[model samples]
Target: MFGVGMSTAYARKLRWCTLNARFKDSAIVARPGAIRAGDRETFMKIVRFILALAVGIVIFSLTVAAVGAIGHGFYPPPAEFQQIGDRMSDAMRAQDQAAFERTQVELAEAMAAYLPTAPTGSFIFVVAAWITGAFVGGGVAAFVTSWGRRSVAMLVGVADVGAIILVSSLLPGPGWMPFVGIAGSLIAAFAAGTLVASGTRTKPSLSRKAAP
Candidate 1:
């Protein structure tokens, strides 16, 4: 009888030990899956952010081009400058580096002479285009991102500022032009981000309050 009792206790203890081991093994198996899931979520978020930035940049470029085209239509460049542009295009097509460089120098000289004499309206128009583009692009970026909307908007602003500086360097503009562009883009982006965030917050709260 004592031997039987001892055997029964040993069996029960073995079963308990086996169950405990299985529980620990299951927990160990679950940890990696949870970690992988979190990593995947983070990676997807990054992809979404990149896509949003690309879309925003395209929109910004298009807006700037459209507005600048309209400005050009209203305030046409001199015929001499147009001729220079034609030559520049021909030089590019012919792959004549010397001709291209000569045309660029001619264009720069002509612009330097003409811009100071150009109407104040033209300068204002250019600044307006940059501001409009920044506002629209930043707002769109904020709207597109699922998270980090403000950061995305700010990124758009920074991109615009960089582009403004680059273009100003390449093509001569008034010394104050870049500063204005930088300030306008930053303000527009901030306004866009704030507006979008407020709109998003209001919608959700309204819906929740309305829910019975």
Candidate 2:
């Protein structure tokens, strides 16, 4: 009887051990699955952010262009040569040198007809709009792609700066002012890209395991 009892106890212990082994195996399997799931969630979040940022940047660029176009009306033809030539012809035909000189002065004044002392304000608005838009776009792109945010941001910034400079050149102003605005816009875009790339939120990891 004692031998039989000992055998029964050994059998119970073995069953318990088997159950514990199975539990541990299940726990181990669950842990990796949980980790993988967490990683996937994080990747998805990053992707969404990048997409949002790209859209925002595009919107901002368009806004800047629209504002500039609205502020300055349609781009005028080269007034210095064409309009002046017309005026000179008219003056010469009328036999009036004084009138021709007057026409030149009038043409100069017309070309300088932009609002005075407010160019700085306009520049600020343009730069702000562009930077804000670019930042948002870059952030979204970075969030979407785990890599390449920096390159994207830099590219966008350079393009925007170049565009702003070109537009500024077309405006009626002292030649130096548009160049300055372009420089400022470039600086602002770089800063904005950096900010957006860094702003993407990383996902947290999750895991699970069976208790020992």
Candidate 3:
């Protein structure tokens, strides 16, 4: 009877041991899944943060451009055309070919003087406006679609080139300044898009099956 009792106790102990082992296995399996879920949530938060930063930069740029435009309109540049027209009027009135030729030289000088003087505050504002406008415009364009993004880049390039051409016609200087703005905008938009896309791709899919 003692031997039988000992056997029964051993059987009970074995059954308890089996249950405990099963419980430990279940806990171990559940831990990794919980950790993975936490990691995915953390990654998503990081992605959101990055998107917010990009959007903020774009908005800041637009604000700067708008302010610059308002200031420029209020304080217009020197009127080169009015002086030139006055000279031409005098030349026509005098009806002296020699005097008109001399007046033409003087008018040219006056026009040159009207051309943007270096170290002007307006120059700084213009630069800021171009840079900020490009960045904001490009970012908005990028958000539309992939094709729209590329189109934005191209459009910016063309617009900058056009501005440079237009400015060059009025004033003499290097025409490459606007190109720099275009390139900068394109690069910024590309970087923003790539970062956002990569972040999206790296995000874990919650619907995936957990490991056994």
lDDT on C-alpha atoms for all candidate structures: 0.87, 0.61, 0.58
Off by over 4 Å in 3: 1-67, 70-76, 79-111, 116-118, 146-151, 173-212
TM-score against truth, every candidate = 0.85, 0.44, 0.39
Where in model 2 is the C-alpha error above 4 Å? 1-9, 73-159, 162-212
52-80: candidate 2 lDDT, tens digit per residue: 45664575577666665554443333445
- Among all windows of 10 consecutive residues in model 2, the one with the lowest summed lDDT is 202-211
Clashes (backbone N, CA, C under 3 Å), per candidate, total 0, 11, 0
lDDT per residue for candidate 1 within 1-212, as digits (tens), equals 99999999999999999999999999999999999999999999999888888888788888888888888888877899999999999999999999999999999999988988887777777887888888888888888877788888888889999899888887767888889989998899878878887899799889999999
**Candidate 3: TM-score?**
0.39
Predicted structure 1: lDDT: 0.87
RMSD of every candidate to native, in Å, equals 2.7, 12.9, 15.9
lDDT of 2: 0.61
> Can you give the lDDT of residue 23 in candidate 2?
99
Rank by TM-score, descending? Answer: 1, 2, 3
